[model samples]
Target: MTQLHYDVVIIGAGAAGMVCAIQAGYRGLNVLLLDHAPKPGAKIRISGGGKCNFTNRRVEPKHFICANPHFVKSALARYQPEAFIEWVERHNIAYEERDNGQLFTLEGAGQIVAMLRTELDWAGVELQLNCDVVAVIKQHETWSISTSQGQLTSAKLVVATGGLSYPKLRASDFGMKLAKQYGLEVIPSRPGLVPLQMPARQRAWWSDLSGLSLEVAVTAQRGPRFEGAMLITHQGLSGPCILQVSNYWQPGEPISLNLLPDVKNVAEWLLDLKQNAQSLSGALKQHWPKRLVQAWQTKFEFDDHLANYTQLRLDQLGTSLTAWSIYPDDTAGYAKAEVSLGGVSTDEVSSKTFETHKVSGLYFIGEVLDVTGHLGGFNFQWAWASAHACAQDL
Candidate 1:
């Protein structure tokens, strides 16, 4: 087998690994970045429907979920979103801002990948694709990596393999497995920013309303809440609102949805409509699609006219409309998740450098860590920030 040596070897040629390789190379270190995939940035290519939500305009430590909440502050503080925005501007990548400060490429996600590749070229970093790592072992001062290509050694090894989310993109448990091999702790991981599935009975009803979407306020029993557009999928529910709340949701937990978010004083409004003998469907039609209103009324078996309900019944109806409780059967799983919720425990990694506390010259960054960001461009921002931190140390 051919053997090679480098100052740094980064696994995974995704967002984090590429950035780290560029930075280390710029620092005059011989850096080699490897990936099992045929091409770089497969996930980036599909993000934001091919536009790629690269970063958010507003970012804070609070936007992330980690076992050690403070673990991300140092890296995030060192590399703000503005710095990334400046990089994008310097590359002349056209971008636009969407709701909630999300910044996306105006042309395509390919531009971002091309920009990173250009940087890597400028830094003289070596990239090896379709290289699968077979084993990783460390001696006193050097790390040995066994790959399909050959055997290699490096003074430093950075795992930016990310987490198991998009299996089609060649996502794997390699990073977490490597961490365990090194005697480091890994937090249990799960799917995040994924769609929720409904029970069979509920699924039957919701499936009928598939493709119908509306803005809603969703609250989980565990205390997390978000207001955004919710989509009725054939399987259950999705869209921004459901995806955001799913981050805090657990099995058997009840989620409440406000079908009438725009309506204040629903009880009084219903009472007046009841007194005037107005049709309930007509009132709901103002906020919901005609098909959705029809399907909801049929599933709930609600009467058409408010005259059919008494004052007490009207109050009950108002409460039901304002707080429709639902228990999800499960999430759509990692196959449909946009990001993984947890990975290498943050407690074992340095917040300032992303170096593993238990191992010298070994670092973890990006989605492979226990840091997960809220929906939108926050996850990508975390990737950039964490990579910058680890690269600076390298």
Candidate 2:
């Protein structure tokens, strides 16, 4: 078996790991980054439909979900979105800002990966791909890692293995497992930024409305309200709105969706329609897809004209339109999840340096920590911020 050593070794070659390696190497540390995959940045290559939402113009600690909400503030404050924007600019990477301050590459996601690789090369960081780690053991002050390639040691170790989302990308629970091995607490993990599945009873009806999408304001029972486009799928609900709420959705909890998101007052509009005695079908057609309107006609059996609806019925319809409660069967799970919620408990690590409180020379960053960000570029920003913070200490 071959043996090697480095001043700092980072596991996972994805966003956080790569950025951490670059920062540490630039600090003149002998850095080695390892990944089990054949290529680095598989997640980055596929993010934002290959365009790569790398950061957001407006980033706040509020965008993240963690057991300790305040834990992310330090790192995120130290390395803001403008810092990454500056870094991208230095690399001559062209990017554009979309709705809600999401910043994506104007070219392609591959450009971001290529730029990171180039920076890694310039920083003199050794990147070893297709290297699977079997075990990690700490002896004295050194971390001894056993891998498929060989045994290696490092004075400092960074576990940026991320969370258990995107299993096809070789994402694993190795970081959490390592934390357990070192006596650190790990929060139970669940799928985040994923779509919700409808109940079996509603599946047939929802399936009929598949491919239909509409703007909506959706709120989970305990989560914040998000205004975005909601898509009806064969199984259930998706798109930006549903994905945003999925982070806070719990089993058996109902989600309230405002179907008429643009309408200032649905009751007033319905009353006006009543006065005009307009056909309900025609009024609904203006807002919904033809098929969806047809489905509603079949399910709700609306009166031919608004004049027929009693005052009480109109009040009920207004409430239904404003807050339609839906109970989801479950989430799409890790396979369809963009990220995972829950991880190494933030209380066990330093928010400034991302190093473990229980174990010296050990650190956890990115999604592997308890921090999970909202959709868009917030997760990537967390990755960059946490990595930069960890690298500075290394």
Candidate 3:
């Protein structure tokens, strides 16, 4: 057996691991970044349909979900979107801002990965790909890692294995397991930014409306609301609005959707329609697709003219339109999830340095640390911020 030594050894060469390696290497430290996957940044390559939403123009603590709400503030404040944007600018990567300030590469997601790889090379960071980690041990404040390639030792170890979402990409719970092996608290993981699955009985109805899209305001029970484009899918519901609300959605919880988000008062609008003696289907057709109106009529059986409905019935119909609540059978699951909801508890690690308080030199960063971000590039910002914070301390 041969032994190699480094000042820092980072597991998982995804977004956080690469950035941390580059930052630490620039400090003149011997840093080795290892990944079991043959290629680095597999997730990055597929993100945003290969365009890669790298960061958002506006990043705030509120954009992240953590057990400790304040855990994200320190790192996010230290490394804002502007810092990453500046780096992107330096690389001369062609990028464009999309809806809600999402910054994405114009060429492809490969540009971001290539830029990170370039940075790693420039910083003198050693990258080991297709290396399977066998075991890890700590002695005398030094970490020893046994891998298929060889035995390596380092003073510092960073777990940036990320969360389990894309299993086809070989995503695993290695980080969560490693944290538990060290007696660190681990949060229960769940699929996030995923589509909602309708119950078997309701699926047929929703499936009929598949491919139909509309802007809607949606919220899970006791959760924050989101307004975006919602697409009816063959499986159930999807699109920006459904994916956004899915972060807070739990099983058996009802999701409320304002079908007519632009309408200030549904009851008032219905009354005005009543004044015009409009049929319910005819009124809805003005704002919705003909198929959607037909489906709604079939589901609710309320296609009568307004003249037949009394004031109270009109108000009731208004409520139904404004607050249509539906219970989802489940999420689309990890296979279809954009990210995992939870991992190593933030309480077990230092918010500033991302190092475990109980075990020195053992740190966790990125999605592996029970921190999730909302849609539209917030997650990538967290990866950059958390990695930078950990590297600064290392």
TM-scores of all candidate predictions against the true structure: 0.96, 0.98, 0.98
Please provide, for model 3 over 147-243, each residue's C-alpha lDDT reduced to its tens digit, 9 standing for 90 to 100: 9999889999999999999999979899999999999999999999999999998888889889999888998886688998999998899998999
Off by over 4 Å in 1: 1-3
Error of 3 at 314 (Å): 1.0
Q: In angstroms, give how far residue 319 of model 3 lies from its true place.
A: 1.5
Q: Per-residue lDDT tens digits of candidate 1, residues 243-289?
A: 89888888999899998888878888888888888899998999999
lDDT of each: 0.90, 0.92, 0.92
lDDT of 2 by residue, 1-394 (tens): 2238899999999999999999999999999999999999999999999999999988988898998889989999999999889889998999999999999999999999999999999999999999999989999999999998999899999999998999999999999999998889999999999999998998999998999998899998886899999999999999999999999999988999898888898999999999998887788889888888778767766665779888988987787777988899899999999999999999999998989998999999999999999998999999999999999999
How many clashes (backbone atoms < 3 Å, residues ≥3 apart in a chain or on different chains) does model 3 have? Answer: 0
Prediction 3 global C-alpha lDDT? 0.92
Q: Name model 2 segments beyond 4 Å from true.
A: 1-3
Runs with alpha carbons beyond 4 Å of true place in candidate 3: 1-3
